[model samples]
Target: MKDTKDSWQDSWFDTCAALLTDPQNLRVWSVIVSLFGDLAQRPGDRLSGGALSRIIMPAGIKPEAIRVALHRLRKDGWIDSARQGRASAHFLTDYGRAQSAEVSPRIYTRAAAAPEAWHLLIAEDGAGQTALDDLLLAEEYFSIARNVALGAGPVPEDIDDDLLVFDASARTVPAWVRLRACPPELSEAAHGLLRDLSQADALLPRTPEAISPLQIATLRMLIVHRWRRVVLRQPDLPAAFFPADWPGPACRAAVFDLLDRLPRPALAELEAE
Candidate 1:
């Protein structure tokens, strides 16, 4: 088993990466996840806003950012908080736990703290795992996948898209992957995992192993599922998060350019599969 400290650090790192990539409420969500994740390891597995402020605010974030994030997290069912004496104590919800499990199988690798909750990772077949991975990759490559499916439409719209008639078919591919029947709490956890993966890219031990094309396809599928959450949450999110006069106009632009350049069957074709 990995060291407990290492695991904790990895969890927080994942939360950060997800916050940065969040299509909406990026900063707000980051603080909330950071606070709750930290509390998850505390003495009573809980902490108060004042305690959290001492930890997150010193990092130079504004107080408003922390408050907004925490409020939204609570509203969205990712966490629960109450007055513990003079301080506000916070704890993860079952939904948060399930979503966390989705991000890293390691979170669910051992027995659960609650016996009623099932771990989806423990339930997936190898193909299901690959499919989930591919969904994520597909979301990352949405523009490309769309163009490859049916020419070009709009630029990559901040991870949201038109109600693709094909999304239904794509969902079926990962149907075998039995996610723990939980609420949107898992959504927050998924964001947490994304944050960690993005930030800890450098620290994670680089495996020089050769990955198969099938694995890449599976990853793409996972990306799709990951981004689909944003789509479901915000049907009409904005685009062009990049600032004006940004030195690299082509950075995000290049993603769409490549999207239009892909050779595979369009997203429609994948759905037809």
Candidate 2:
């Protein structure tokens, strides 16, 4: 019985590791960003070189790759590293932490929040286009066109006075409008993630003891990383904005289901390992 149990555990670990890996183009730096944001984004939280390596290496990233990524991140002002005697530790810079904090709520939300009220802003063809474009870039407004923008909830008091604003809700979304909101490529990526998550869910072992905390951390990073890529690209538009066959809702459900099963391990627990 002992030998059989051991075999089962070994098989489970291998399968879980494989399932969590990013089959698509693995951007080592982006993966590290996800890890730091998820596990070490607290005000003073930091990860030692060894701890960072241990958390990320399970995804098949090499130590050399990690070194290069850290250098690039530092150069880009996303992270800073300090040395104590022979050991080094890394942490996000204030700018980096702020940027991460800005997106944290969106990335970690288990359920989508659809606002009850929405408003549209329309600019005169050539007169107010630039101001509208700036608003689209600086805020969460979805661009329906060069002169049109959609935002949730009530119109802000600070909106540009030159542009026309009206309270609106989606009534009938045509194919062209839906296609414009969620392009074919984004739809494909969403569907692909859904399939991968479903496969991973099936491969996970029934016994909770079969997995360790570090393993849970690794898996959560992968899940969150992939989900972030999809969700961030998608605005919180009405359901009508999505394609008829968009798999976003289904993908989100699967992601949270697996995440609920793999509860997060404390940072100390991960570092201690």
| Clash number for each model | 33, 0
TM-score of 1: 0.33
Q: Candidate 2: where are CA atoms >4 Å away?
A: 1-11
lDDT of 1 by residue, 1-273 (tens): 468856754454344333334343446464455334322522335655654554454334567887887788888888778897876777677886555445432221222122221111111444334433444455422221222221122333342222232321121312112221112444454444344334433332333222222222222222233333432332111122112322122222322232222222222232222
Backbone-clash count (model 1): 33
TM-score per candidate, in order?
A: 0.33, 0.91
How far residue 242's Cα lies from its native spot in candidate 1, in Å, is 24
Assess the local accuracy of residue 191 in candidate 1 as a C-alpha lDDT between 0 and 100: 46
Measured with C-alpha atoms, the lDDT of residue 145 in candidate 2 is: 84
lDDT per residue for candidate 2 within 151-251, as digits (tens), equals 99999999999899999988988888888889887888888889888888887877776777778888888988988888898889989898889998898
Q: How many angstroms is residue 171 displaced in model 1 relative to the true structure, after the best TM-score fit? A: 27
lDDT for model 2 comes to: 0.86
